[model samples]
Target: MKLSILDQAPISSNQSPREALQESLKLAQAGENLGYTRYWIAEHHDLPGLACSAPEVMLGYIGSNTKKIRIGSGAVLLPHYKPYKVAEVYNMLATLFPNRIDVGIGRAPGGSAEATNALSDNFLQQVWNMPNSVQDLLYFLDNDIPTEHHHARVSASPIPLIPPIPWLLGTSKKSAILAAEKGLAYAFGQFMSDQDGGAIIKQYKDHFKPRKHNESPQVIVTVTAICAETSEKADEIALSSLVWGLQRKRGEETHGVPDIQDAKDYLRNEKDGLLDDMKKGMIIGNPQEVKKAFLTLQDQYNADEIMIVTITHSPLDKIQSYRLIAEEILK
Candidate 1:
């Protein structure tokens, strides 16, 4: 069982993005030392609280700071990018750090309409053609061109000896099926959904096709967690993240992660089911309790890796959570 991290460069109301980013770098190095297999950063636009807009740019910085943990995008929105450009950038990364980069793609806009438009024109049209774009990306990476292929002349330059692994991010069975058909590994965002993902994972594994990078089915389950010394303390520390999830759902413009008092204040006014919904994929408990809870998901999903996404108002808590998990469970 391997543990990995998915950092979104969380910002708290009390701190600036500069501090959040520095913490992200420090956390990545800490995870590397703690025996984490990978450290992937998420790309979110138009969300002030989520300070990671350019995961590719951050990957270079993270790769340089960490020794062994694989550094890559938790997801790069495929629809917004030209496949060739994505290939070129990640290819360069692979050259710099061989056998340690992952190219995870997602279909979500990662922002609002205005932000999507800011990224590219006809964003939805590109989204509608996502399958084609993914195929193009694969072809570019493998340097393959079908007979009479429209892009026969095009090629991803400076192809490294070790290519970045392709990961498809999704939250449903349909997404799993699509990944299987494309011969790509699948990562289910259990953190994003409020449902059990065992069925979808089963579907993906049953239908997966063998490819060069993955001859067998590969699956990673990403979920939220906050580990501390005690359950009460864990819940208190997780307050900010719990509130942030609700805020994102309510369509409110979040600044940074909020404090325990803010979380309590927000929950007092919100609907009864809001916290319930946020708790669906989250594991909040002490070190031993968290280990037990995590094992349940890992068992149900039969996961190759369990990716943890932690959020806290304090960088110290965030680092400490990963540290406790590493010392008590991951090792």
Candidate 2:
């Protein structure tokens, strides 16, 4: 199976944005040597705890350092940007690293309504226009006729010699159906729900109709993975990382990654119901256990790719965990 890395650019109290970005690049470089297919960064706006507000910029940085691994956004919030501008940015990247960039699109806001409105004036209207936005993006990349002759048309320089792989990222059934109908690859967020990924994949494949761009349905499942030498250590690390989501759900805004002590304290006061919900969708364990769990999902879903998001209190621990998984498990 193919492996990829996805980063939320989690902020830690001790590390600065520059430091976190440096470490991310190091991890991407290491992942390349270890045989990962791609390294993707997520986009989040106005989140103090996340530094990946602009994934396209981060992608360029990563692409400059790594020679073989493909780099792109796990998703760019399409509703917040103009379709022509989005196409131009990705098209340029694809030109710079021919056949090495993948554009993953998502419809979610990625942040608060206030933040979304701040970024785009017509936030609600943009959400409603996502389907058309995607269609327009595809048209721009393929150099097809513009929808309206009166509207401005943007084209890429050195014009993309080859089409970049387009992926539809979603955590819901609506995304699955839309992806299939449009003949695009589908990526399911396994971190968000406990619903059987196999079922979602089956639904996508059954309804998929091949288009000129996509001949077959491709499915990727992303899960939170924390691998250590022992299950106990992995669980401890995962718990600390899981606290961030808990804090977010409780309407608390944290600036950096919390220490184990702080995370433990937060969990102590939080309701048990919230904690239970967080644990349902996560996979955290030693190499062997993680491998076993992932294999189960792979077999059931007939997964084409397995993407892993590793979260920890320290950058070193996060990188180490991924390295361990790569060497001891995925290898």
Candidate 3:
């Protein structure tokens, strides 16, 4: 199975944003060396524990540092920007990287309500007009705006010889349908969504309408996982993210990912069931067990690739987890 990374640039309790981004670059380099297919960075804003706010900018740094493996935005949060501008930025990236860029798009605001307000004038309306925006963006990328269209005379400049591949990132059936209708590859964010991923992906394939000759539906399933030499160690590493996620859900502001020991202490008074529920959406195990879980998800979603998101208090541990999973699965 094809393996890839989806990095959120999670900041550790004692690490600066610069350090987290440096870790992201190291992870991308490691992924390429391990024979992974892609390395996608996420976009987040006004989130203390997450460092990335501009995936395009991060991709530039990563692309210069790594070779071969595809580099992209996990999802560009399309609702906040103009289609033409988005096309211009990624098209320039495709030109620089040359057949190694993927432009993953999403409609989510990618931030809190206040952040959303700060980023866009009318976030909801922008989301409601997502389909048209997607079409416009795609047309700009292809440099094929219809003559009758209002913006026909304009162009998304710096067009590359080969355009970047577009993947629609979503978590629901409506998103699946939109992706299918647009003939874009669909990436389901299983780590974030509570929806039936298999059903959603199946719906995407069922409704897929090719925009180009010989085009076919493509799928990627992104999941949260932590792999180590032993299941116990993996579970221990996962606690940091689990506790941090809980705090976020409870509307608590955290400085960064708590230390593993701190996570253990915080969970002591919490209900055991809360931790169990969080684990339901995550695959925390040894290398072999993690591989098995990934295979199950692959078959269930009929996915072409598995994009993993691993968060830990130590950046080294996060890199180690990816190494363990890659060694076992790619072997």
- The lDDT of each candidate is 0.89, 0.82, 0.94
Query: Which candidate ranks first by lDDT, i.e. highest?
Result: 3
Better of 1 and 3 by TM-score: 3
Candidate 1, residues 30-117, lDDT tens digits: the string is: 9999999899999999876888999988888888877778998989999999999999989999989999999999999998888998
Ranking by TM-score: 3, 1, 2
Worst 10 contiguous positions by lDDT, candidate 1: 272-281
Instruction: Count clashes in each candidate, considering only residues at least 3 apart in sequence or on different chains.
Output: 1, 2, 0
Q: Could you tell me the lDDT of residue 56 within candidate 1?
A: 88
- Which candidate leads the pack in TM-score? 3
- Give the Cα-based TM-score of candidate 1 against the true structure: 0.94
RMSD of each: 1.8, 2.2, 0.9
Per-residue lDDT for 279 in model 3?
99
Q: What lDDT tens digits, residue by residue, belong to model 3 across residues 92-141?
A: 99999999999999998888999999999888999999999999999999
lDDT of 2 by residue, 1-331 (tens): 7888988888787789888888888889988988888888999988877888899998888888889898888898998888778888888888888888888999888888789878888877887877778777777777774557434355644468876778999887778888888888999998876676678888999999775743999988998888888988887787777887777767887867787778888778768787566766777888888888888878888888889998788877888888887886557
Q: 223, model 1: CA deviation in Å?
A: 0.2
